[model samples]
Target chain A: MEIYRYSMYPLGLKKLIVPCRQLQAFLQDLLESTDHLKAVLVTDKDGVILAKATGPDLPDHVLEPAFSATFSVASDQSGKLGFGRNKMIMSTFDEDQVVQFNYSPLILTLLASSKANSGVLIAAGKDLEEPIKIVGESVSKAIQHEHKAKEYV
Target chain B: MLKPKVITQVLQQANTAGVHAALLLNPDGSLVSFAGGTEKDAKVLAAVASNVWFGYERYGKPPAANSVEGGEGKEGLRNLILDCEQGKLSITRTSRMLLCLVADERVEWGLLKAKTRTLKEYLEGPLNLVASY
Candidate 1:
């Protein structure tokens, strides 16, 4: 029977390949100037994390649920609440968090301190749009390539 | 003529009841008919169809079984209707056309259900007739 479980990218994709490293560096640079950015993760519409940036000590398992919940909340709010395509979702408590879904499939989620500058965060997000789109498209291609490789084996 | 008339009727019904918006989309997530008052972007229809496809694949039963049951009954592959505070979406089985209605959360559920019932009947007759021919 077929099982449904989250699978990681193949070893070829995992190797410090040019595209993968560039994506990581691009994300790290994108978040560097933003203050109190606790974490940033990019995931597909199906809740698969394509890439993530977090503190060194952060565990791996937390990424999946965080991305899934954020996507669900954003999609639900857009559908139910009149959020107008759900460009951005901000949740402010002891800390500030922002989740943005662009181009229908790619999601960029960020966690920051309450004192973080909302304007800066929004600006940085806007600037990252092109890079994010490139990364998302590349990741999608990589996934497709991996699938084809598996089928041939 | 048939498509536009259907659009007009659905919009009129939704407007009389103070709904937000309504739309009709083809199986490939393209707009075939639209009504009501709201943004008329094609993206909205695509988004709604994407969600509907996801819901059907995840929670819905098999397509053939759903058709058999819906056809035997009056449902006619009516699939699922999602209710949101801003709007609701209903997909028809025959051509995979979607009827999306946006309304205030305050709108009465019973009233909406009644309207959908009327729509289902109207669509079922014409759709089944076309299928047989």
Candidate 2:
């Protein structure tokens, strides 16, 4: 299929939110495909971790709380550059290249080794770009779903 | 507190070599010293780059950018070269400080890389002393 979709019901909400099973699965597939991938983190605009995958060799400490807070600060502060909105930030390290893709309220981080195919890594994110946007919308639906459930209860 | 003169010296040297700006930043994205660009611009760069650095440093051993060989070791991070659309930004480190260089589009990357190492060595002595205190 050219397009993929999956359904998720956030907590108590009856209305199915944006299809994220595919996103989560895709994230997993991404981790599995890249041998040197350290981790993958998906965060809301506030830097809340929605989902994550830890690679074979890397420790979870790499995605510690500090990273979320840093993302929050960066999103809040980076808008002033007058460059519209920063869609992504790529930082090159001697050992690896860290790429963060911004899909509005959601950000996807891919950690790959320096030896890994840069083009392939970039493609992974590009292929999922639309899915990330769907993830963001789903998160909002989940939030509203919780709110509605609270009101009814 | 870092001696501010170190930044001026770095800027002077970088400027002579045709680099646009030079600055020192803490890993936490705090500004230590900057030689070029507006204050706001430098601060933003510090914040973003440090966030990237913070995430990258904790991934265990970084591969030595041994060109394309991707040699592995747990040396943390040694340097970063960001070749952006407009220009290039290079970061090298002392034991306790991060040196950032914003190069013009036509700047000599090889010389800038070498200069960054020298700057790191220069800052290491004073920064390490403070670290021990």
What tens digits encode model 2's per-residue C-alpha lDDT throughout A70-144?
Answer: 444444444443334545555556667666676767778777776776557667877888878877776777677
Compared with the true structure, model 2 gives a TM-score of 0.57
Please state the i-RMS of candidate 2: 7.0
**How do the residues A25-143 of candidate 1 rate in per-residue lDDT, one tens digit apiece?**
76787667667765677766666666767755444443434444444543554563342444543333322344344544577766555567655666776676787777666666767
True contacts kept of 2: 0.10
User: Which parts of model 1 are misplaced by more than 4 Å?
Assistant: A1-17, A56-64, A76-84, A146-153, B1-133
**Candidate 1 docking category?**
incorrect
Candidate 1 whole-model C-alpha lDDT, 0 to 1: 0.53
Give lDDT: candidate 2, residue B2.
Answer: 58
Tell me the deviation in Å of residue A32 in model 2: 3.7
**Model 1 deviation from the true structure expressed as Cα RMSD, one decimal place:** 15.0
User: Residue B109's C-alpha lDDT in candidate 1?
Assistant: 45
Clash pairs for candidate 1 = B20-B102, B87-B102
Against the hidden reference, what TM-scores do the models get? 0.43, 0.57
